[model samples]
Target: MTAIKTEVAGRTAAPPPRAPRRRAQGLQGSRKRAGWVMLAPALVHAAVFLLLPMVMLVALSFTDYQFLGAYHWVGIDNFVQLMSDDRWRTALLNTVLYTVVTVPIAMAVALLIALGLNSGIRARGAMRVLYYMPQVTATVAVATVWLWIYQPDVGLANSVLGLFGLPPQGWLTNPNLSLPSLMLVGVWQGLGAKMVVYLAALQSVSRDQLEAAQLDGANRWQTFWNVTWPALGPAHFFVFVTSTIASFQVFDLVFVMTKGGPGSSSTVMTYEIYENAFQGLQLGYAAAQSVVLVVLIGVFTLIGLRLQKVSSDV
Candidate 1:
């Protein structure tokens, strides 16, 4: 029996090793070639479109270049000048203020709308469409409609205020109110997509856990705080990051509605960049500001991620 076992073991171990090993190596090589082939287009696209443009922008930022003029290297002069530019400083401050104001209010409103819609209300589908319409609408069209609505003399907003015996507001014309007015437009346009996201997140929550909470006599608020909120952690993080970034990059509404008007009170970073690059013909300065914008966005996103981690750990 020992001899039989030894023979069986030897038979199992004695297969020709070189051919199978070579076959595996060949298969691995083929897979690598296939992967490279599949990835080549994307890599080429990044190099040509993204990487090349970034390199060009960085190079341009160091030069005293305009859109149509002789270019010469200035060695951080553009960045140095940016430090003292009052217009740029105001633009930066306005951008930060806009982001701080818009993201929280928009997210809160969206979350509430999602909760209401998710509660199995009648005509929920139509309501969803209605909420989502603003998001899908063209920005230009929305801005045009909002411009009409904000007309202090004959607009719907003033009419509504009149109905309640309240005074009309100088929404876009007032320097102090222009930024907030743009922020409201942004919130309105952004609410629908975020509400849809929250609705989707709410749907994925485990019904069994909710049922168990109810069996344990948990109230709606308690169940939400303990079960629903935790489950929506990922959604919250996503909405926060994207909403913050969008707020920081806000330009369309300002450009369309205000044109950075009312004594430059509504000017934001993106609009500032556009003004420097095209309107003011300071491409190098715009490039430097653009780099700063990129850095700010990256740093803020990292901080948000850290906060999310800390909250999750707690």
Candidate 2:
């Protein structure tokens, strides 16, 4: 009787172990499927929107899809047309040049403002509101105000210059001054947001580090160079990347002020793309120009990322 009981007990234990093994396999399977289910929406969005549209753009760039209601793939024709065209070349150059000039200057001014705001002066709150007001103001209003200021006579800008004994000048009419004038507005409108970002970053700097630097007899400039600036790595990276991208795509101010020029001086890539598609009625060509701009922006974004502490903890 004892031997028989032992045999039955051993058989029952083996079947219970087998049942648990099966249950483990079933749970693993369910987890794997749930993981895929969680990612389905993101995958669907990329396929339907981003991936599909990009694929269409590349295909359309090769074809003559302007207004003929017919598709004819002419390999490299669009690119060839773009390169041979002088106007397009000029517009491309202007875009690149504007990007180079405005990005650094805007970034510097934002840094200065950020430093000022961080220093906690009297009426700091009022000053912060003044800087940020441009962001909340309507674009049309801003442009209108600037137009009045830029007027050659009876304008605030010229009046101020008269106090300095400078001659009256055309801020927007002179091709040389038009781009810079636009840059001034761009700086004013953009600096506030970036300064806010930098202020947030400055607040996070380790107080101990700054105190220790002072204890070591480090001057304010030296302390900022070593501690404060390093803490601002992420904020600097954010402002530079976004402002550079925005600079390349500047159109509204150009449209409002210069309308592409006194000889195409203000015609950046975005404006050119607009002209080619809408005015020129060369949709395929415009798409190709857009492709080039996309590539250029991608290259700049990568460079900006590399310039900051994106990949490193420092």
Candidate 3:
């Protein structure tokens, strides 16, 4: 009433509306609170499980913390020892070899499978489920089955070789064959998940662009390189990073199948860490190895990201 009288008498113009502005501010505040509420659980989990353990690991790396003995600060002694540790070197090399061999093969094969499936292949759903079975299966169970499959005497592999008039080969026992055998298993287990990612990416590719490329007389390979591949950039990066990390952290299969043994031929960094921490009781040294593994993973991931960026630019 006072505002109306003021407006009528022209004594003072009514103030600009404040309610809408205040309401909007209030709504924005509520939204922010809601977002934080939604994120709290994940943030807490990371802090507790990831960040805290990482901090402890770094701290432990500088101390000789054996499980049954008193510990003391050793500065960089553990890292220095790793420099001359032949076992550590062997583990690192084998791990790198495994990662290099498995990741690209897995990605390429998965992408091909995805492309085939995306083309409306018959029984596509069944095929996808079949391929994905290994991924969903327990790693221990998969490794155990593979263990039987790799057995020299009565294994499926040797039987198949016999059918081909070839002698039975020691798949896991032979130093030359152990790592490769593991690589095959790694690639096989990983393919389904990678294929699913690629299939989704392939489906999202622009149909109009593909048609345009076809109309321009581009061959299948040319069309794919120009239209489909570029669109899969995100998928490629995701798969590469994840596959690399998984490869680096591979342990269960080695533990179950090889035990890094017949010597250290099949040993990888993760297995080495486990051996040192548990079998050898060198917790500090194992922590240092863990740190190195983390560093290597970070470096490789960065290299992958850079390569992806360069490829995308090209």
Candidate 4:
């Protein structure tokens, strides 16, 4: 009877060990399947929208392809040809000039506006809304108003100049002034958004720290440099990078106002791409240019990120 009891106990314990092991394995498999099920929609969407389009673009860049027309593989010929394209060179230079000119000036102005709003001034909220009005305003409406304001004759801009006894000037029509003129519009349009961003950042600054700086005999400018500016690092980086990207991709304003003229004076990368793909019908070459533009944006973005990282570490 004792031996029989021992054999029964052994059998029960052996099955208990194997049973839990089998159940755990099954549970792990089910969890893995559920995870994949959860990710399936996102994966499918990325494949359809981003991955597939990128693949097609890269492929098209290697061939002499047009919209709904016969295409032939041309290898690197298109890319080689694009290297010497004068129009592309001019567009690249103009884009760089626009970015350099607009981004710093806009950021500086936005910071000042944000700082002014943040001060213990009456009607601060109203001022903020007023400053941010341009962001929500329709681009077309803004462009149309700006077009009239830039008119060589009886425009608002000229009228303002006349008040100061300054002569009326050709704003957009002059090649030398065309890019800068468009840049002013760009700065005005983007100022509101950047100001809002900086305002949000300024709110996060420590009032106690600011007060401490004042107690230590620091003036307004010194307090800002030591206490406020460092706190706004993230916002500053974001505005700088985004402003740079927007300047590079400037197309709509050029299309509506300049049409990349006064003879390509204000042409940018995006405008060039549009002209090539739609107007010139050189889809392959345009795709190559698109690839170049993507690279340029990526390079700038990476540089910005690296600088941000370095600043944060410091």
The number of the candidate with the highest lDDT is 3
Give lDDT tens digits, candidate 3, residues 1-314: 99887778784565778999999999999999999999999999999999999999999999999998999999999999999999999999999999999999999999999999888779989998998899999999999999889999999999999999999999999999999999999999999899999999999999999999999999999999989999999999999999999999999999999999869999999999998999999999999999999999999999999989998898
Question: Could you tell which candidate, 2 or 3, scores higher by lDDT?
Answer: 3
lDDT preference between candidates 1 and 2, better one: 1
Poorest stretch of ten by lDDT in candidate 2: 305-314
| The candidate that achieves the highest TM-score relative to the unseen native structure | 3
- List the candidates' TM-scores in order: 0.93, 0.85, 0.94, 0.86
Native-vs-model 3 lDDT?
0.95
- For residue 168, model 1's alpha carbon misses the true position, in angstroms, by 1.7
Q: How close is candidate 4 to the true structure, as a TM-score?
A: 0.86
Error of 1 at 227 (Å): 0.7
Q: List the residue pairs that clash in candidate 2.
A: none
Candidate 1 similarity to native, TM-score: 0.93
lDDT of 2 at 69: 65
lDDT of 2 by residue, 105-182 (tens): 877887888788888598889998998898788767888899899999998999999999999988988889887788
lDDT of 1: 0.93
In lDDT terms, how accurate is model 4? 0.91
Can you tell me which runs of candidate 4 are displaced by over 4 Å? Answer: 1-43
lDDT of 1 at 291: 88
RMSD vs true structure, all candidates: 2.3, 3.8, 2.8, 4.3
Comparison by lDDT, 1 against 3, better one? 3
What does candidate 1's lDDT look like per residue over 1-314, in tens digits?
99999999999999677988899999999999999999999999999999999988999999989988999999899889989999999999999898888898999999999999999789999999999999999999999999999999999988999999999999999998888889889999999989999999999999999999999999999999999989888898899899889888988898899999898999999999998899989998899999889888888789789978887987
